[model samples]
Target chain A: MATTMITTLDRSSRAAARGLSDISIRNLFIIPTILFLIVFNIFPLIYSLGYSFTDFRASTSAAANFVGLQNYRDLLSDPYVWSNFAITAKYVIISVAGQLLVGFGVAMLLNRDIPLKGLLTTLLLLPMMLSMAVVGLFWKLLYDPSFGIINYALGLGTFEWLSNPKMALYAVALTDIWMWSPFVMLLSLAGLSAVPKHLYEAAAIDRAGPFYTFFRITLPLVAPILMIAVIFRTMEAFKTFDLAYILTSQPTAELISIRLYKMAFQEWQTGRSCALAYIVLIMVLAITNIYVKYLNKVKER
Target chain B: MRKTMTSLLAGIGLVLACGTSVYAQEKELTIFWAEWDPANYLQELGNEYEKETGVKITVETTPWPDFQTKAFTEFNAHGDAYDMVVGDSQWLGAGSTGGHYVDLTDFFNKHKVGEVMAPATVKYYAEYPGGSSKYWAIPLEGDAVGWSYRKDWFEDPKEKEAFKAKYGYDLDVPKDWKALRDIAEFFHRPDQKKYGIAIYTDNSYDAMAMGFENALFSFGGELGDYKTYKVDGFINSDKAIAALDAYKELYKFTPPGWAKSFFVEDNQAITENLAAMSMNYFAFFPSLINEASNPNAKNTGFFANPPGPNGDQFAALGGQGISIVSYSQKQEEATKFLEWFIKDETQKKWAALGGYTCSAAVLKSPEFQNATPYNKAFYETMFKVKDFWAVPEYAELLQQLNQRIYPYMIGGEGTAKETLDALAADWNATFKKYGRGQ
Candidate 1:
């Protein structure tokens, strides 16, 4: 009786597949997703690329005219744009360097057998989980000269952090490191925990120094994943906007993304801002490509 | 047959009644504005409107930092999230040019919105395109940058004698810009944790520009030709340079950490008694004047902006106007709401609730001038206040002003003349992009 039932079910399934071919079934399942991506993602990118060549302002009803790369030329030639780029690069270097040092160091400390490891990791990860705007705002209050806890604890006696143009960019970078170091630590922890125990045993037996052992064994194994973290963070820092915008308005702190935002939304120079965005995208992609190539090289070794 | 006809008439009457009830239920409105003291009062006034007319009012507000971005985002999308908006005065230029606001010229005139409000408010907050007679908004609130000071300290005999001995004059409300600086310098004692003044230094928006304009107008300098949009000679004139220098000099006397201060910081400087005087918008004075909120409310007094060397005085305008959004589907209802809002009785209630109404009757009345300590100063400043360029290119102009002035004011980057020359060049370039100048 069971055999008869199994045969009957198999016959019904075969009957259902009789009309539709495998290719048709696959298309039925995949067409909607492909259409969604093309419509929402690709279309806007192409449309904006078209606008980058025009003199269109989103704020006005004036008709767009084909300026034929005038926006790109103007952006490239502008000294102010270059300054914004330089500021962003400085911010990325400081913020990413701080994150790498703090995050890797924390991961190394946590790699040992420890109590409350899950809870400890969760507490450290809280900063990265909160909204960027919220974090920026809280840090702003923390950096306030008159009432902030930072001044109170350090006994700096009304020392200016965000208000000082020379220090404002670094102040924001410090906050960025505070907020994002946990992200790197989480990734680094995953890589740290995966290393074989026998290597450490061998290094211990050989009396290899901590630094030498790290440089030779642990680093080689973790370098590929670490590169992945660096690539993601570098790209993100290049596109930083809300945190910098909320924390400081000093021209010294203005990143390229903030400049792009001012042009697109504040000044309503839609076409020019689009051109600026393309420039940033190309730069980020180029840098990311280099990092990815190095990451594959490490993986091969 | 007669019974059937009677029943049919009864059914039709019931259907009509149901439709009327549904219409009343749908009479809802939303007005977008910056989150501030006035927005709270506006909500209270809106509650009264709802009570009287059965039309529910929803007041949506965002923080001042992102208010402009929020409004522009909605306008760019042409969304109907708000039926009306209490937008900044300078926004009239962009709103009308971009067709974001309804053409309210006929309604404004028909309702006599101009005749009922102060003349300056009507001109600055309502009209666009200079003398073209186009109106986009109704003057909802009136404000200006005015001075607030420690009245108790000024009245003290010891302080008076000390100030007089040092400045060689009576220690009283400043009569001119020189006296103002003198008073600031007198009160400046950083060792005691007591500073002289709190002024706008924030580079985020128009804070620094507005603070500097007070000196510029009084010093007999202009931003440029308001009619023809010229900037080179006027903006970088010797007098303009003097005004820029004067503002920078005042920044020296403020508390050490006020380099990025604005209205909120200025208010804190006063309430915390950290400064002897501060500059802030009159719209924010209600909190400073309310005894419940501020411990030194009674001791804090208001004063008009001081005159310059030539005895010329003008305050920077800080107000907004109400307009029906063009994308709203409830235009007629929103129009009805405005007609009711600008009435004498409603405006009186608005002022009583701490909402600064532009109604001449409400502002000039003895009860209003004497209502709060700051009310009288607000009334006086409204008449003499000067507004920035309310042209279609205001955003670009402000962005450039912030960049040029911030470095010099905060970072102490260059000489005053050099900074002004760079600002003039920036303005010229912006205007040139708009096909206005060579």
Candidate 2:
């Protein structure tokens, strides 16, 4: 009876294989996904690209005219657009630097044998998990001059964290770092835990100084993953909007995304905003490519 | 196989029947407006309408900052999503020019809407320009930037004596900008955690425009040559500089974070007794009156904006009008609802229900005049209103003011004169973009 059942199952399997070719089965599985991508993603991307070359106001019913690079030229020459780019660059640098420092520092500290390690790591990662809008609102309350607990704890005499333009951008950067450093921390923690214990042992036998051991062994081992984390964070920081928009109203804190929003929605300059968005995308892609190349080089070494 | 096919066909038939029945059961009409206290009243009224007509009315609201963008996005897509919209007065130009709103000229004539509401309301809120005959909306809510002060503090004997000794004048509602400044200086008690006034300076939203425009207007500063859209001399005039200087000077007496203050923060200051006075919308006065715990509830005093050196007093118009979206599928139902909403009886109920209806019958009623402590002030300020340009490019122009004036006044970045000069240049460029430049 067992032999008969086995022979029947093998016969069905052979029949199924003959019914559907491997290539046809593969195509059947992937066609829906490919169609979805074309309909939702590629269509809008190409449609918006076409609009970027026109004089189109999204809020109006007037027909779009092919202005042939006017929108791009205007954006490139606009001082206000340049100012927004400058602000975004400054914010990206400050926020990413702060995240890398705090994240790497915490990861190194946690690399040792510690009590309540899992619970502590989970609590530290909470900020990164919360919604950005919720985090923005929470930080706004914390930065309030009259009622915030931060001011009370610091005993600073009425510091306007999100009000003063001089301090507003930095205040927003601080919020970003607080929320996202845990992301870097998680990634670094993974890389740190994966490093071979034998390498550290070898360094110890050589009587390498702490800094030398870190710079030579641990860092090289972690560089590729660290570069990956940096690249991810750099792209996110450059597109930062919610925290900056919700926390501070100061022009000094306006990022490229916020400026793009104002141009697209507020001013109804649809074509110009599309052009601005594409410019930002290209810049981010270039930066990411550079980081990726370095990351590949690090992996090779 | 036959039974399975029959069941599948039955399921499809059931779904179609249910869909058709659901569609026919209720006629839905949606009204889009900003999220505010009045939305609850509108929802209540919508519920009442449903009870009377068997038509469901849905009131959808977005935050004030997002309302314009959301409405425009919906309208620009030419979707029959919204039956009616309560949009900002500045939206009139864009809505009319872009054909987003139904041209209410014929409806206005048929209903005599111009004769029903106050002339100023009809002209400013309904018409594209001040006196344009083409009506695009019906005035639903009347509002303007007005002043409110702590009457108890001003009337306190010790405080009054101190104010008199310091300013050489009695502590009273300021009639002019100078008196207002002096009052602010007198009551300024930052050491005791008390601020003189709470004024909005945030670059984020319309706070800066609402808070500063009145002062600029009072000082005889014109935003532009309204007819020609010329902005150079008017926005950067010496008088404008003086007005901005006076406006910024009050920052010394405001709270530490007042530079980023909007309506919520300003109201918080007044209710918390952190600030002795507040500049806010009259539409918000009812909320102030309802704050039982706040000293302002019992001792609030309202005043129209103080006059300038030239004795010119003006209030920045802060209100919205209701209009029919051109693309609404339920246009007839929405129009019926509007007809009911603007009726004399309904208008009275609208005011009583916490909506600031602009119906002349309601405004002239004794009940409406004495409805709240600030009601009379609301009436007075509505008549003295000055509005910004109601053009398609209003947002761009307003942004220029926010970017320049906010940095100078709130961030302490540049001189008032320098800020206004830069703003003038920017406005000129913006006007030129729209083909309105001189």
Candidate 3:
């Protein structure tokens, strides 16, 4: 009886109630989160942003004087900085691509009916769960030219894995691949499992071979999820630090993140390092945007 | 919108609150030190300082390997996490560039700390580059490599007679590189649980660098000329190559797992009666006096590093120096702490606590010299000390030397000539970069 009385109310009263609700300050639950972000994250970011515009040497008071764009100008000219960025790019591109290929391959293999499937899946993910520093240091000891188990087993007559400039970056990359490939494999496996069986049945009725069926039916269905995996892995690869920094020697297979750390923390040129960090952030975002757009287009099709 | 404004105001309020707290403190100071055992002694000493002066002092320390990296990071960041740091003498060149340390020469002179430093130590360890008369750090510890021997083994009449029969000399600790090797070989009795000598090589390259540098220094071959890039004379010289060769010969007399030894490991071997003789820093003598630290090691003895053909015995004088952080707000308080730190009474207390002999006043004081069982030996060892090259590029130079030369020299992976030539070339290039070459 009460509900019917409210329904019997005029449209003007309902409109007044809707307007009041829309403008109510009680609806602002998100304000606290916003303020928390501004204080904890955004403020420091803005301060760092301001620093990027100055020279801002931390160690010496004489070098602490502001010299606008000089840090950036020096960074742009430094070959070592560019080399490190190139190394980082190589690491990201190679690791992401390799992860996708290997992950997709593993996904396809694991998607089938197999023995002890759950156990195998759990065992494979063990590497990914371990700390990156531990992984790096573990690999470093393993690669020790003298006492390492790797050399002892392979009988490879003293390869300076971490010490040598030629092998150090790849040595770090090998450890990364060992750790994260399983993560991508799990993602792709989930994507593969979600594909409807009816699509495969339809292809089978049409006398399509396994390869053709996979390309025409399965890839199209899983492409969106695979793209998601790529996006996540690419961003992670860009920010990779602990492994390379710990496992490998400096300035040899130097990556952008490590360079940023060294510049900001070691060189004490915070402004320049901040600028470089922002550059990395921008690049990663740009790549992510493009990848996401492509995934949306695939979905639309 | 009102809520958003209110929260933003709250953030501003928090910032102001923190800012006010920072402003309230008139001064703050942080002291950076290494994880050596003595740092704990210094921490106890810091309490005395705080009680005397109202200023608070905080200490931050890292292991020897990471200490420089940590200090360098804070300095590079202009982060005032430490108001002062105790740095290795070898790192002063690199630390000088970071520019956080205050030039204490004038302050030291005015306070008479410079005048009080031992003459031999000041001429080498405390003197800054370029004769600038500016001291960046005050000497905190002085360490030099010396030989430790088992006197009982040599004193055995039968063994002494056997030694004279084989080597045409008394069976005493050898006084030269070749003689040391010969004695080591003579003493090696694998069936009787004895090895002639021990050199620790656990962190293979690092251990080798220490041994190699000692040999090079003893043979009168410098790593590089600090002022110029003309490093060819001593680096790849006949003397340097001969020293490397002698190290190789000494290796044959060492026991199994010899490659995995360091200073403490080799010292442990001697103390445990596993080896006849060991070469290590002078600082390890105090451990021998304590039976608790080593039950088997008894009646341990010390000697100067063996001389070369030129009769000049030399060893790397590894020490640390303390300096005030230039950015510290409490310079006056920190300096006052340092002034108290260098006092004879204060120095004696520190040295007595099994710390390195840092100040000459304490080292020369009869009370300190005769206070401990090993005090006489350490004081005697101090007379035969030299220092390592203390240039800014010393880090990079050491890396190059250790990586390319050490493996070949000690690992027997490369010939003496090949190792020396490569090291010389690297040294020449490095010296040129530092404006220390022709």
A108-219 per-residue lDDT for model 2 (tens digits) = 9999999999999999999999999999999989988888989999998788898887899999999999999999999999999999999999989999999999999888
lDDT of 3 by residue, A169-250 (tens): 7777778888888989998888899999998998889999999998998899889988888889889998998988777543
After superposition on all CA atoms, what RMSD does each candidate show versus the true structure? 6.7, 3.9, 7.9
Better of 2 and 3 by lDDT: 2
Query: If scored against the real structure, what TM-score would every candidate get?
Result: 0.92, 0.95, 0.68
Candidate order, DockQ descending: 2, 1, 3
- Per-prediction interface RMSD? 1.5, 1.2, 7.4
The full ranking of all candidates by lDDT, starting with the best, is 1, 2, 3
User: Model 1 over residues B199-284: C-alpha lDDT tens digits?
Assistant: 99987778988999999988888999877889988989999999999999899999877777899889988899899999999988
Error of model 1, residue B361, in angstroms: 3.0
Model 3 regions lying over 4 Å from their true place: A1-126, A138-174, A202-241, A244-301, B1-29, B50-56, B63-66, B76-81, B90-99, B123-125, B145-174, B178-212, B227-309, B364-438
DockQ (0 to 1) for model 1: 0.55
Q: Which candidate ranks first by DockQ, i.e. highest? A: 2
- TM-score of candidate 1 on Cα atoms, chains taken together: 0.92
Q: Looking at model 1 chain A, which ten-residue stretch has the lowest summed lDDT? A: A3-12
User: For residues A129-170, what per-residue lDDT tens digits would candidate 1 score against the true structure?
Assistant: 999999999999999887799999999878899989899999
Docking level of model 3: incorrect
Per-residue alpha-carbon lDDT of model 2 for B282-356, expressed as tens digits? 877777777574656877778889899999988899888899999987778888888898889888878889888
Segments of candidate 1 deviating more than 4 angstroms: A1-32, B1-25
